[model samples]
Target: MKKVLLLLMIVIAVSCKNETKKEVKKENIIEVDKNYFPTELGKVFEKHGGINTWRKVQILSFNKGEEVHTVDLQSRRTVINTPKYSLGFNGKEVWLDEEVAGTYKGNSAFYYNLYFYFYAMPFVLADNGIIYEKIDALVFEGVKYPGYKISYKANVGNSSDDNYMIYYNSETYQMEWLKYTVTFNSKETSNKFNIIRYNKWKNVNGLILPSEITWYKKDENGLPTAPEESATKFTLPLISQVKLADSFFEKPKN
Candidate 1:
């Protein structure tokens, strides 16, 4: 009788342990499913209309490295006002403010005159179907951000250098920083665009916008400092309407 009772008690204990383990497993699976995975960012981009199209942007830019230079520019500052042309600027330089004149002169000037076209990938990622790679998490100002490294590649006939990486904050889903490499005359130069720790996202014409932006180059410490080469800020106006022709995206004639 004693032997039988001991065996029964052992069996009961084993069964109860197994049931507890199963419950723990079930809870773990639920937690995994509940996580805000990086894939959800793709959905957010889709909901925001997939990048290539954004109207009315306001940007405040700053330079990194030696001295922190700043600018306050608006998009409507360079309105061409012609049926075919319009121009925009960021205080220091013109971004895209041109009307399709008899020739594609403004288009050419916009590309070669300023690096605006080269640096437009951050904004174009939504419309051009940008791809994201999971990178390390970024911790800033006491907040831990799940980071997704972002990049873009050009399609047929688009010579714009779209190869660059951007870091999106995990919690806010806002772009926190960008790292890019550009080749000039066979020499590759790397740059980082850093956010100076601020909240307050602005919505512009159905799209979200980051009001402040700063540029920096990665340093030996693996942290962001001010960028020395070229930096500027843009303050966009309230753009109620935009009428860009198809030719605006084409390359200018030689």
Candidate 2:
């Protein structure tokens, strides 16, 4: 009887140890997932609006001059309409319709989501398949801004070789500037980076979004020199929890 009792006690102890180990392991995994983003960039996302909040967004729309651009946040379907022309990506191909307007001039594939990516900034950088590295600080005028360099994994996007650098105000943790390389339609990557300044911002549905973005002329070293006379600006920014129907982004029939 004594031997049997001892054996039973030993078995209970071992089972409890195994259960405790499992619990600890599960907690460690949750911690890792919670902290997947680098510390600094994580703060940026929080300041803009938590990354999780941005992820929950189903649709986002904004206006650039007379053009209304709407994007399906989850599927990356996009549609842009102006008085003269309309274009969109139906998840598979980029289509342009100028029947009511006129002829379209720019490359449809490249321009489809260009502004959306730019407007979405720091939050978009949190997307999967992106690798982030700490980079040197950028000193513009007299202010010093810290930044991170972002690159995509192989076969991630239209241009995986393209690189982006995001600079933020260290004190506020708000993104202030962005530098990106144009590798579209190129087999090889380029080192030249064009800069855009994000100074004006507004809050829409708890997310910090750009109201006006300034483009600057590049110097000999390809860094921004002076603010361009014509800056790309946005208005009527909105975020929706409801996604548009798939047919909304489909090619228009005419």
Candidate 3:
């Protein structure tokens, strides 16, 4: 009877210890799922539209100023159609309407892509190769905004040299000011940075997008110390289109 009691006590202790360990593991998993795994940018994506939703969307269509832009988010394919020029990239290849006036090969491809990228915010920043870090609240236009700095690993894209500082509203978490380096040509990380203020935003199919994006050139000191104080660069009105066919991005036979 004594031996049986000892064995039972040992079994009970072992079972209880195992249960406690499992509970600890469960807590750890919950914390990781909530915090580190998703990332700060992931939180922003959830605010706009969950990454899964954007991933499920095969195509995103929009208009910026005079051009109609359609993007295949999954395939990374993009099409920019304007009255003057049409450029298409099927994720792997970028095609431009050569017969149309003022279409250069890589230049057109780069420009079309750059425009689309800036227009599609928050989500575009959620890309795989991006590294994000929380930065001190930015003091802009005499107002303060919570901000984060985003950089890319080498070979992230055509220009990994680029870096972005994005500021968000403290209460709403919507984006406000964006400062980015335009180093598309040089591999060096040292490049002049530009600023764009997100004046307004609109929601399309659950995707939060900027409606009016105002550009600002850095001051003579090469930094945007204040809002709208620097020479106002060209401001573009952004628009959105929806559900375009893949063939729209394909080259047409002239």
TM-score of each model, paired residue for residue: 0.44, 0.84, 0.73
lDDT-based ranking, best first?
A: 2, 3, 1
lDDT of all predictions, in order shown?
0.38, 0.79, 0.63
lDDT of 3 by residue, 144-223 (tens): 77667778998998888788878778776678878788776666886466788877777766777777777765667444
Candidate 3: C-alpha lDDT: 0.63
lDDT of 2 by residue, 119-213 (tens): 99878898889877777787788788888888899999898998898999999999999999888888578887888999698998799999989
Write candidate 1's Cα lDDT for 1-254 as tens digits.
Answer: 22223333543464466500111122222111233224545444433433433423332221122211111123322222223433433334444333444533545224332333322323444333454455555544565555444444545113344344445556545655555544433333334333333223445455555444556544564555555444344333232222233232232333
Best-fitting candidate, scored by lDDT: 2
lDDT of 2 at 107: 92
Question: Could you give the C-alpha RMSD of every candidate to the true structure, in order shown?
Answer: 23.2, 17.3, 18.8
- In candidate 3, the residue pairs with backbone N, CA or C atoms under 3 Å apart (3 or more residues apart, or in different chains) clash, namely 61-241, 62-240, 62-241, 63-239
Off by over 4 Å in 3: 1-40, 98-106, 219-246
